[model samples]
Target: MKIYITSLLALLFSLVLNAQNLEKYEEMPEVDGVYITQNMFELLSKIDVESDDPEEQNFVELIKNLKGIKVLTTTNVEVGSQMKTDVNSYVSSENLSELMRVKKEGKFLKFYSKPGSTDQKVSQLFMFMIDEDTSEKRFVVLSIIGDIDLSEIGQMAGELKGVPGAEELKNIKDEK
Candidate 1:
């Protein structure tokens, strides 16, 4: 009984330590974070669209499979550095594979993914980016959890306005 209690305590401790890396930033005053839950996706998926466009239809289907999306952005140099470290650790611990890296218009973006049902699909899409164009450097991390179809990711990105690094998602399809 003592051994069982000890093991349970250790498991709970580890779970807290390994909780979602960027989640902490959500409450920090220096960081701006947006978290969309699975329930939100389900509601979005149910919304009827009058358009007959295949692209719109595909976007709805893609939303149905999405679990959640979390985005964190910061302009504080110190906080940004910490965010970068946390994201690096998260990627390593999660065993996510590097999908691509891009440097454009003074912004550096790195994308990683966990494999899904097929080579073109991913269970999660993670992006870390730094913008060096302005006086204050900006850091952004975006995590999209779902059975994401690479071909339709651009539409989802477009739907999410004001999300840093979202535009970069469109390039993902081009990379494939």
Candidate 2:
């Protein structure tokens, strides 16, 4: 019984630590971060939308299952380097599989995901991007947790317009 309790507590602690991978960057002056909680998603799902379009309906359904989203961006060279390392570590530690990689318009984007309920769905989507066009290089990390439908990811990107590196989500091709 004692062993069981200890194991359960350890599991909960690791889950929390994994969830807060990007939290440290939130308070840093050099990092721009945005965190949207599960409650916000719940509220968004409750909004009444009288749309007959299948695509629109699918978008709503997608939003309903989302738990949260965390975004961290940095233009400082040092911070950007650190973010790259942290993103790599997070991906490996979380055992996320590489979904895709895109390099276009002076930006390099890499996506990773954790398995979901179905082949077309993902429990978590993680993105890391580096922009080399500007004099000051920019790095971005975006983590989304939920039962996400890969087919509707483009809609998610549209909804999150202006979020750094979100536009690249449209490029994801659900290959197997």
Best by lDDT: 1
lDDT of 1 by residue, 1-176 (tens): 99999999997886677565667898999998888999999999889999999988998999899999888889999999999998898888778899899899999999999999888899999999999977889999888899999879976777767667778787687765
- Pairs of residues clashing in candidate 1: none
The C-alpha TM-scores of every prediction are: 0.87, 0.86
- Candidate 2 positional error at 6, Å: 9.3
Q: In model 2, which runs have C-alpha deviations exceeding 4 angstroms?
A: 1-21
Looking at model 2, which ten-residue stretch has the lowest summed lDDT? 167-176
C-alpha lDDT values of all predictions: 0.87, 0.84
Candidate 1, residue 167: the lDDT equals 80
Q: lDDT by residue for model 2 over 84-172, one digit each (tens)?
A: 87788778878999988889888899999999999888999989999997787899888889999887876667676877766777756
Off by over 4 Å in 1: 1-15, 158-162
- C-alpha-based local distance difference test score of model 1: 0.87
